[model samples]
Target chain A: MTLRELWFRLTYPLRQRRIARDLREEMSLHVELRAQELLSRGDVPDATDASLAARRQFGNATRIEGAARDAWGWHWLDGFRQDLRYVLRQLAHAPLFAVITMATIAVGIAVNAAAFTFYDAIVLKPLSVRDPGSVVRVVQDARITAPDVLPFSAYDALRKQARTLASVVVTTPPQAFATILPGRSPDEPSIAAARFVSADFAPALGVGAAIGRWFGPDEDAAAVIDYGFWTRSLNADPTVIGRRMIVGGRSLTIVGVAPEQFAECTSRKPSYPRNVPHSHPP
Target chain B: MSQQTLAAVEREPIPPGTLDMLILKTLARTGSEQLHGFEIAETIRERSRSVLQVEEGSLYPALQRMLVKGWIAGEWGHTPERRRARYYRITAAGKRQLERELESYKRVSAAVALIIQSA
Candidate 1:
């Protein structure tokens, strides 16, 4: 559309009221003139009869006014506004129906939103890990897709024959430990949650140490602190690696600080990781 | 004693789509003197010798459409009796439209006349 046409459409509403008023005024005047014409021509005996006859001959004044609005290209808009106002008045007269309708719509929207959220979180959004499409937790069928922990011998056998798959990781529930850090009071040891996992857990989940390397396979007493725990309890100490910390009255070496993103694999983030042998702890 | 009370409906309704032409022709013939809505309707009726009727509904909408199309311009003025009224004047475009419509109307009506008479 041309700029002038756009400008006219934009400004038309401002002129619409005056134009509509003028049309009404002109139509009424035409009726009055027709009535006077009838009276002057001796067609009717009285002014009242003449006026009524003139109006009848004029044919639906309200409809003519509406058609005039249509001629100016606002018929539908004016009609819709009038309809909407009428609907609002009717709705005001029946408040209960309005409330029930509004409530039904709200409940429908809430259900749809909640269902979509769950679908997105569980099905659409993938787990945040490197090559996550290639990784999946194996669920056993002892009780219909149960997450039963596998024995070390079964895990080892599967690991040997699964040449096409990445390394398998056996993760266990986190255990609470009364942890005492160096230079802190041993009496008021903080309760820290620590995860136990196979040595291959770090490489399998693509976890990298923020400070030191992952503890060696033989270092069974060493532990790796999570990034969040390192920052909250240890102030992100750079040289804290190789330091000995007391856990459950036993001293264990602080081997590494794992990156922050590693915490997303489980429901609750572990404060630190304690290495378990390839076999489950006796 | 209006049109309804008259015998046999003497005034025929003006043909559709010809209202604009009649309105424009009325304004064009008057030249400098701008006529109001009532005057235009009155002129058409008298010119047709009371044989043609203009419904106010069709008349006002046609005038409005012409105003929007730049064929006619309207201004609010007072009648001789000091009554407020809208006066309309034909524009150049309206004159051109009147000539076109008149030519077409003459052609069609002549064709109809020839057919009816021949038949």
Candidate 2:
């Protein structure tokens, strides 16, 4: 192929409209010439009839015009553009179907994304503390050749004897305690999800308080609240520190609110209105 | 539309791919003068004694293809009545193509002739 032809084909999209007009005009002139030839030969009665006869013999001019343009090249891309336009028009005609289809695809992607985000944060992600790799959980199991379910009686024994390790702390799971809110009637006390932990629980985990402060070592009747309970039941009261709440029939003062992320360490099930009273384990 | 008109002319459609050669031959015969699209179709018909009829559908597209192939060049010119028309002139490539097509056609026809005569 010559460079001239190659250049023409490469620039087809830019010049297609002008080329189409030129082709139609050229074919129309062909029709006019055919009409004159018919008149010279007396094939038709008058000029108008001769012209119409010529047009009839030429077949569809618009179709011929399209075929002539197709010879220039890139007809497949043109056909695809037309098909896309047709699909868009149909989609616009049925707005509900378009919305439903879009929503279905969006929800499918969102579900996978959300599940992965949670799995990464909870199971795969490390705990947010200094030297998280060094921190370990100690529990007795048959596989470890130790007695299962360490009782609260071992709390003092583990601290005194486990001096070989860097640090040792003990904590009891949430215990049942009837709780009274500041605004509510004291008689209608609901169960408060409370935990009793050793003095080194916060220092061992290296997590600090989000508001107020952690409890003092050997402190009595001082309560620490996680951020969720502070907002949900206590209405995120700024004066929550030093405010007293009746738990287990004893008044415990709120000392601090736990940071939001630290809530994962205290409870796995995410209970509400949590109170961690600094008392002996269990 | 009518059997009468069909019987009078007995117009036969040009064989596929032969129209380009015929067009090249028509332009070559015109020598220095360029022939527009209608004249080329008419010349082919008249030369074939009205046996061939070139449809605008085939004629214009073939012209366009030949134009892009560098086998023919078209330019807008005025008719005797001062009306605008596109005139086509055969190029060197068109003459070469015409010779190649004629050689191929002759060889194929001769082989067919040999087979038919044998049968």
Candidate 3:
């Protein structure tokens, strides 16, 4: 990245070679002195014999050289490869232990991967927004046995009074709803789960429609179809926007089409249409 | 007894992996005097009163490792007999490692001694 780092990387091998040469020379000198010591001590008479004896005492030269080179770093992968070979050799000797160890490791890895995927989907992954960290959920702690619910009055009060929140929108829990296209098969209506929200919901989530535009405050009876529903049911008609669709017996205009992966407020559910009315129960 | 068995019974070998620490200790004891591989082996053997004999096979490898670790520094020089040799002297890091190894060795050996005495 920098000139100094580039220089170091370029010159590293030369430095390593010098170190290796020095180590080999040092060991050679030691062996020579050892032979001389044997001669001086009268352990061996002939010069060649003493030198041979000293070489024998010094053990395998190639193995020691390999070990000395390993100490200079950059051989970590080689060390790991050697360890793997050793493990495979041992596994060849004991097949059952190897199988059980492999099975255990496989199971451990599968479980860990599954848990990490679940965590990433639910908690680690942020909502698709301009700044997901700035998004906050406002919950009313009723301190009762029932689940926490924000009353409509309280929602309105928070929306009006809260200075810290950039925007406030109220959404109902998702429930099953059916779509009724005009003059479609009367016997078979397309069914889907739907969520109702206030006018500020889409803006607060900080997502724009893939086609057309989000429903504004005046468009109370408008709906935005999800990308999947638009493609699968409407055959991805380009002029689907401004088309009229009856949802729950109420004729509503399709104002926009949400992105394919944009599951409103959650990842697990399919990307279904969201209706933003002027006044909605919290 | 066979000659090999007799030799094995004659003197105990220095324990494995402690050769580096012992070499550092020897260099520290000699202070400024740098020791060649042979002298280091001899000093270790003598200091242990000949009870511990450092095999030439292990000594060279240990020295090579210590050199790479930068615990000890080596340079080509002449021995007392005017023989060319690579003399090694302990660095500051080597002295610190020697102190740590000595402390741990003392504690472990003491614990072993206590257990043996109780048994």
Tell me the number of clashing residue pairs for each predicted model.
0, 0, 0
* Ranking of models by TM-score: 1, 3, 2
Candidate 1 vs 3: which has more lDDT: 1
Q: Which pairs of residues clash in candidate 2, taking residues 3 or more apart in a chain or in different chains?
A: none
TM-score of each: 0.60, 0.57, 0.57
> Residue by residue across A116-190, what tens digits does model 2's lDDT show?
888877787677665788887777776755443576666557766876667776665566778896667887898
Docking class of 3: incorrect
**Model 3 over residues B36-105: C-alpha lDDT tens digits?**
8889988987788767878876777688767766689888898777777788999987888899999999
Among these predictions, the greatest lDDT belongs to: 1
Most TM-score-accurate candidate: 1
- Candidate 2's TM-score reads 0.57
Chain A TM-scores, per candidate, are 0.61, 0.61, 0.64
- Candidate 3 regions exceeding 4 Å error are A1-82, A90-118, A129-138, A142-168, A181-183, A203-206, A231-236, A260-282, B1-73, B76-119
lDDT by residue (tens digit), candidate 2, B65-95: 9999989999999989888889999999989
Supply the global lDDT for candidate 2: 0.80
Candidate 3 backbone collisions, by pair = none
Reference-based lDDT, residue A216, model 1: 68
